[model samples]
Target: MTGDGPGVTLAESGEFAVIDRLVAGRRQPPWVPLGPGDDAAVIACPDGRTVVSTDMLVEDRHFRLDWSSPHDVGRKAIAQNAADIEAMGGRATAFVVGFAAPGHTITAHAVDLADGMWHEADLMGAGIVGGDLVSGPQWVVSVTALGDLGGRTPVRRNGARPGDVVALIGDLGRSHAGYELWRNGIEQFDELRRRHLVPHPPYGQGEVAARTGATSMTDVSDGLLADLGHIASASEVSVDVSLDLLAADLDAVAAAGAVVNADVRQWVLGGGEDHALVATFPTDPPPGWRRIGRVLDHPGSQPRVTVDRVPWHGTAGWESFRVD
Candidate 1:
């Protein structure tokens, strides 16, 4: 479909045609009994329980077109939502996306977005079952991810107890380090720059922790302190994080901090969007996780997280209403 000129617009292609392009060559996982083209998608939950989570990414607030390609934005929308299921010790099985953009937006860009979403979903043996498209003021992507627990009880945030060890798997603060590098226009840190645009969450470690008897688990979407605080509050426990245990994580971004004259500790402790899984284990953590702290009985009813036994006075994490 062509518009008045050479470069075709979504307005010219119309809704059904553009959607056809988005789902044209895509393949669905076997669990998807009914994929796109129907009024609804049918996903099989063999374990008899479904793990579900949803997230939204708005233009400019969550991402900048100048900074992220449409493909990058698509990967991010699916990744963040899938991370939520991982936090609950389940594997993502399928996703449904609702995307909105101006009618003038290029149809090819929308197709690229779908391609990026498919690429990330394929990493975890998941599928893009269904979604919707609409014209709006700006780009917005809303994703709902469904997962399977494989008959294991979901590891909750309230099961931690005194003497449990705190552990984490996957990179921490790398995305924030990339954000700093991208904002300051310093192009030396190529990996960091890419991380800011598209995060790489530990894909399958959630089930590993669950199998290893994780008492409580969560993905680090917020800063380490803020996210750990959720577990502490739920479990009525106090947590102490040993910075000495985080030397490798710190060293990973210390050089970037120096280049920007920023505090590396804040990036690691207060930064967010690493999507790394953190959990409490009664014994030694599984092979992929590193012990970073310990859970203790709360001194008072109010639970808290500390770095070296002291409260963090710096920035804690990303506040949704205050994204700037």
Candidate 2:
């Protein structure tokens, strides 16, 4: 209902009501010992190891309501953090969210956002568990996810050996291309644009990699090379990404690159937020993964991310306070 006429803002509907509507009609998985509507949801940790990770999305910084729906933003908040858990070779079990928005925002928007979060959480057989709502200058959503190791050792980022092969799953460069499209007012490539709004991570592949003897892994929240640099730095090894293996991804965005006067390869290698999974394996990687690079002996240079044996010149990765 509107404040004066037909349509009112979120400020009019109220926060509690919005949350109730958002949470209504959602279901959690059987392993979720506790679901939403509680202070915190608990899950069975038979292996006695729990994986936890958190991410924060600030308005304009992480998302724009103009570009994404409340639902889309909510899903993204959960998905990115969950990807962190998956990168550690764990299955997500629950989430706790914190939402900060203006008091005048419509309650319906809040509910819709929560609905989106729940929808995405359901995809991994997890639950929202609990969350907090507060007032703020702009919309701010923070999510922390808890995961179960299922009796397997958690995969860290420092285990790669010199002979380990680097592999990747999920699409690359599409999000960056989409971002370019949106920024430059180029209207072609609807699929790329949609990807900017919602990233599709390869679910369950992390565990598969873990089972297949993956030595190290991390989500590509940062760019492909930038993320791999984390592993390289931690393991004291060098990484060399093969451009040939990434040709298809570059091709996918070549047209978009032309439209925006950008290099598709740069997007493939440097653009982040696709949330793709990249891992290192001692043997052949599992199915659904593509070999992209190899680990090398550490030369004792300051930890760096490189491609073709040299530092990439494109925007390397995302930094919280920097602009592209």
Candidate 3:
């Protein structure tokens, strides 16, 4: 009955056994009234509403098994989805995942992936309440996160106003820097390399921003400017980022950029996947958040994001359909 025994493949164990191994011995949070093993999960909605977000990760596009362990991939999947919920100024309460993998994949790897998901969910006091498993040509992980707003109005991208301060909580460009290092086969900068494999999102900061008077907010899943551009377009405003304010982040990745013969500014400005929360505030940002820029009015004009009062010419963050 040991799915991990003898290096069993998912096909060898069949679907039910593989799923059993993944869900076995896992604990659920109090908010999750019903978890896996039921037809559907029952999550508490004390506020009478739930904030939901979903993301899909395909092998070789979002991650590569050769570069990322099953554990790393699992964490990345959950972290990204959780960030979406956080962007709305909510705390994640539960998740429902859908996993597809080649039948030839090892069952142990699948279990490890589940463990990784649980690891991240635990960090946010959430639970992986339910999921589905299926066979495919490659690995595909799709996660849907449900969150609680705690009686606060859900922050939206269109709420940013002119003169609002732009602040961020979490690191930036480290993942892109890590990707560059991995592509060049450089073995140094262990932390940057690890960051590319699994992102570290600032958990609970979303609710803090909302309570602290955040007008608009988003996680830096795409590059900074690109994600901010979303707020600009939705809010009908322009954003100007100050390079002077981002000195610390640039310095953080400068060494890695030099080693990789890349521009550190591009990484900090345009790199994505750090899942950092960037928001617009009317007053002083809360403690632990760094002020980076300000929002501007753009009435009857196309919304834009700028750096140092000028448009940036570097890579504009990741696009789902862009070909290199």
lDDT of each: 0.91, 0.85, 0.94
Note the clash tally of each candidate: 0, 7, 0
lDDT tens readout by residue for model 2, 170-207: 98988888988998887789999988888888878888
- Best candidate, TM-score: 3
lDDT of 1 by residue, 1-324 (tens): 552234677888899888887888888889999999999999999989999999999999888988999899999889988888999999999999999999888877887789899999999999999999999999999999999999999999999999999999988879899999989999898888888888898999999999999999999898898999999999999899999998988999999999999998999988888898999999999998999999988875689898899888988788888856
TM-score of each: 0.97, 0.94, 0.98
The parts of candidate 3 lying over 4 Å away from their true place are: none
Question: Which residue runs does candidate 1 get wrong by more than 4 Å?
Answer: 2-6
Question: Looking at model 2, how many pairs of residues clash?
Answer: 7
Cα lDDT tens digits for candidate 3, 163-268: 9999999999999999999999999999999999999999999999999999999999999999999999999999999999999889988988998899899999
Which regions in candidate 2 have their CA more than 4 angstroms from the true location?
1-11
Query: Which is the leading candidate under lDDT?
Result: 3
TM-score, predicted candidate 3 vs. hidden true structure: 0.98
Record all residue pairs in model 3 with backbone atoms less than 3 Å apart, i.e. clashing. none
